[model samples]
Target: MSPLGRPVSLGGGVANRGQVFRLGAAVRRPVTPHSPATHALLRHLSRAGFDGAPRLLSADDRMEMLSWIPGVAARNPLPGWSLSDASLVSVAVLVRRFHDAVRGFDGGPHHWPRPVPPAYSDGLVGHNDLHPGNIVFDGERAVGLIDFDLAGPSGVVWDLATVARCWCPLVADADLPDGFVQGPERRYDRLVMLLDAYGLNRAGRVAVAESLVDNHDWTYRIVTDAASAGHPGFREYWAGVAARTSRARQWAVDHQAELIKAVRR
Candidate 1:
């Protein structure tokens, strides 16, 4: 039977690129070349006893079906609660759990998506994209991560930096979400809180600090390529956002030292 779909919002690059839908107890999304590897990763996570990721039910040439995780995932112009320090801490804990769960898998024979630079690969697959929109939360507590489209081999510190870059955001004050309290002091405090919650060691923290700039550049390259490919959502999103990303990249560059200092504390 052809699955009936009620369009659902699961924000990020996929949502921007194509349609996603709720089909009874599952989510149906257009498949990409990366879908097969994503499916394998999900199966591995399930076998590894991680319940935070959606289960792959089935797939074909067109769309893939994943078991729906019942929770509120944020969208752009994020809600006030999702921006709270409590949310920050919960997301940190969740990502750490995900990393631990994925630690045993050695990538095996699967072709994964978005392989990070050799400087950041550590043999274990990282979610790679942990932006607020991709995380599922039960109230203020983040319970699961939804999108695995960008998952691939990555270092623990690199993955942590990616998550922090989106969650703590590590962006310039001018680019902060509306209603998100602004100030480097608050950013530092939140960064510290996240690293502490994730239980990162001193050396790991320093590495994450150093990688922020590279991560930012890496992310921008992906989106720019997608937009160039004429993905409607990305094309719409890429409009006029270049300056902000430039500022964000520079922010990471300028503050790398201070961030290292705080995380080492």
Candidate 2:
């Protein structure tokens, strides 16, 4: 039940399997047990006045329609617009708003689309992935977020950390976009600014920094494993994109101490 006339593009992530189609202005995923939970969350977010996500339309025979959000998604190395301080701050704010919006929604009874690893901290749902491509930007500003296929109950701080890893990057200099590599200090400052904008407490800050290191390996393993399983999107993405993510991961690991000091300063 995607929008009525928009074209559908295939080949992205493994989780996106099962015939994703676009109708006029919506993208639809086939109906499954997880759909109820996803739909419920989407409905709650929409009702809570968070306009940075899709509007859920009723389910059809095999799909559900979600209102199309217009903007470009910053996939990798990110476009310059996504690297600006303004965009980073906007993203932090938007994610914080979304977390607040869904604070009361229940996921206990429904089956989630993906596994929820252990909670990164006590009160946050594991927002497992908040990478750039999942976020929509409008000229150095985050206008919306797409892809909730992995959202589940976990720590709020952990979720924030996930966002930082992508927006602030926290990756090695060589792995960053050329402009960012030239000014790692400024990029580090942006990460701090993003944290401040999100109003994270000291504990949240620590969790974010630590998660960048801890989750890097786990996240990569998950993607690579999924790719090996013959998931078309992931397989294609791994062949062309994931190999480079390892470099970024190594960059984060190598510079953890420096990044922690910078962010905490």
Highest TM-score model number: 1
Candidate 2 least-lDDT 10 residues: 119-128
Q: Please report the TM-score between candidate 2 and the true structure.
A: 0.88
Candidate number achieving the greatest lDDT relative to the actual structure: 1
- Overall local distance difference test of candidate 2: 0.74
Give candidate 1 regions above 4 Å deviation.
1-18
- Model 2, 187-215: lDDT tens per residue? 67877898899998776786677778666
lDDT of each: 0.82, 0.74
The number of residue pairs in model 2 that clash at the backbone is 18
